[model samples]
Target: MTEDLTFNSKMAAVYEKNTRISIPTYNSLFAMIQSYYRVQLGEKAASLLLIGAGGGNELSAWGPSNPGWTFTGVDPSEEMLKIAKHKVVELGLESRVSLIQGTTDDLPKTHLKFDAASCILVLHFIDDVQEKLKLLGSIKDKLKSGAPFILVSAYGNHDESELQARLNVWKSFWIDAGRESSEVDEMVRSAITRLSLLPEKQIEELLAESGFMKITRFYSTGLFAGWICHTE
Candidate 1:
């Protein structure tokens, strides 16, 4: 699992390029998140905490638009943090954004609480489902009552047989780009796999058990995108 973290750090470096190929889907999902935040938090100044904040892309997109907001991005990878720090500087958002290097299991509890938090494409990497729920529970504790926690994860609604077929297509695409078989295997394994997909019901139940109220699924796309939000 530690090696998985290293692989994820490498993956983050290539994320921008990968997302470009899937721009429409990514845009729609981000739009949903933004709209949800605006409606839930209203027009007031707010603070946001981003868990697994690889590359700091989300903050870059959302921060300037909401000038009064402050963002704290936390991730476990030093490589990813380096990229995020550089991005913050490049965007001239140093005053609005802060980067912290740590995992959910080791987050600093002393930091000021946030108005909202997001965990995008992060929970699946945690091998234990219970631990993942516990992480969400901890994040909820770091928020004031009525604060929102938005999450996105792989959905389990896709046909497993078909997804495997499409993954074979992706595998071929990687091979055509000159990656070796072992390299492709490692990448595919570390990327979201079928096994990582969780059902929508399970997600809502976990969030509820973690003390989140008013949990709702907002957007989903063939097991690729699943967005949910709840309040503390």
Candidate 2:
């Protein structure tokens, strides 16, 4: 499977719409994450390190609501980061949001540590298990102790009947959202070629190994699942 999941200019332009269509609960998931963070940090000022922050959806969803929060968003795709930068400017969040066109590994070494972090819809793109762990570990290294972290990813044992059922439901969602059957089929086929799925049990294990604790799954929609945890 190819691990290069970065979007081209054409794909980046329609990312938001396509994401909303493919994941029916996209807004709900963002809302829940924002709510969780608000409840945890309260009125205190906080910094968030957003992994795969390319599309700017997280900033669009969380920035206005949490005036005390600042963001350092990193993504590997230049095209996607362009969209994020555009959103930051359009939302008047330029002062609070920094968009970086690279991975966490590219972030400069510093004493700065974030209050919390999130990796949304990004992990499954990495086909190598160790690379996934490394990314998680890098996020952990940038966070303060006990910092809350959210991980959302597409995961399942493809051989399992339950996963197959969820996949069918997911495909139906795309169809219902106005994607042509052939387009949906092609999308699914493309996703399968790039997606790296793990069972929930394995994901939890990865969290543990990455120095995160108190792992709790907070949301599930179709084939996508989200977990909220804290740094050790």
Candidate 3:
């Protein structure tokens, strides 16, 4: 069986295009998020923090639309950041966008408090529940009080029937996107066993414990869920 794609240069080369095809409601989900940020923070001089800011897709979406919003995008993957940097340069957003090749904890300590933050399609990669909480906590620490946070992730407890059902649908989504049967099976297997996804309840608990409030989900596609929250 083929291994799951890692965030290396090879995957980074085709990441943008492949993700657009593989993930359901790919465009609209991010559109909603950017629109929400625009309406919610409108004209306010704010710095938006992006965790797992791979390829600067968020920057590309939000930068052109909201000129007042500056972005600090952090990701552990250097290859991914290289692609994102290129995008930033291409967009002529170098003046407004900052890319960091590290996790949130690696973000430089400063008096700068982010007014908004996002962690789209991330967090689920962490296998340990405590580590997930720590990641969220680290994000919370960087933001100002009452700042909005958008989090999107794939989730479902492995032991539950609901997770199994969602996994079936999720794999079908890939297959429908034109992936071969064997590839889909291997991808599905990796997602189920290799990825560390949590149940909704535990995720909520982790968010709450990490100082996020008003945790409400605004979108869901198969096993993936998008949440709008606040750091308070």
Candidate 4:
């Protein structure tokens, strides 16, 4: 299996524990985005594209109240897909959801179009800012005019000191577990690198360059939480 799959498999096994903290934060973020879209679009049901959907926790957050919406979730990890599929079946959301194993690059070929799309907490994991921009551009291509695109990523200059402090603790633990120094270094490098954490002005500039209009920061929390939306 690919290293990405290996890492995601390990993550899937432990993601529930991680979500104890992440879910609440992301849930609130998505909720605010949804409210904004509801008011702006005036639609109860939306066709949503979720890039790097992971275990489908975002769908669960939307809940049964918004039965009009349908989600097409895409991720690159088979292991993560397994977890998400299981949750979809268990929650009886199979009818409202479709899970695919791929990245944002594959969306256009999937022949799917969406009224709205979100890439939350997924951009930083991508190592290339240009590639991430290409993916966002592809989403814009698939959306109809006036459709909304929501993006959330770690914000640059928000509070790197805190993240760096946390990474130090994580690095020590990984080393104590007998991981090679090189492996630990790679982990630390990934954590500290902020591929999408450009300044707020820069983010808006990039969004405009990608053919999106009316870009705005919708929410933020420390350096970790950020939300921006634009229309096609």
lDDT-based ranking, best first? 2, 3, 1, 4
lDDT tens string, model 4, 1-232? 6675556556655776554333335567867877876776565567888887877667776645578888888899887787777667657888999888998665557565688888877776766769767877877887777888888776564355765664455566556656787987885466555344565666677678788887777676534555556665
Q: Which residue pairs in candidate 1 collide?
A: none
How would the candidate models be sorted by TM-score, starting from the highest?
2, 3, 1, 4
Name the runs in model 4 displaced over 4 angstroms.
Answer: 1-13, 20-24, 108-112, 157-190, 193-196
Query: Between prediction 2 and prediction 4, which has the larger TM-score?
Result: 2
lDDT top scorer = 2
Q: Please list the C-alpha lDDT of all candidates, in the order they appear.
A: 0.73, 0.88, 0.83, 0.70
lDDT, candidate 3, at 151? 89
Better of 1 and 4 by lDDT: 1
* Cα TM-score per model: 0.78, 0.92, 0.91, 0.74
* Every candidate's CA RMSD: 5.6, 5.0, 4.6, 6.0
Better of 1 and 3 by lDDT: 3
Q: Report the number of backbone clashes for model 4.
A: 0
For candidate 2, list the clashing residue pairs, or say none: none
lDDT of 2 by residue, 1-232 (tens): 1233333334545887888877889999999999889888779999999999998899999998889999999998887887787678768998999888899988878739999999999999999999999999999999999899999999999889988888889989888877788987898788764689999989999999999999999889889999999998
lDDT of 1 by residue, 108-164 (tens): 667777898998877777767888888888888878778878887765534557666
- The deviation in Å at residue 160 for candidate 2 is 1.8
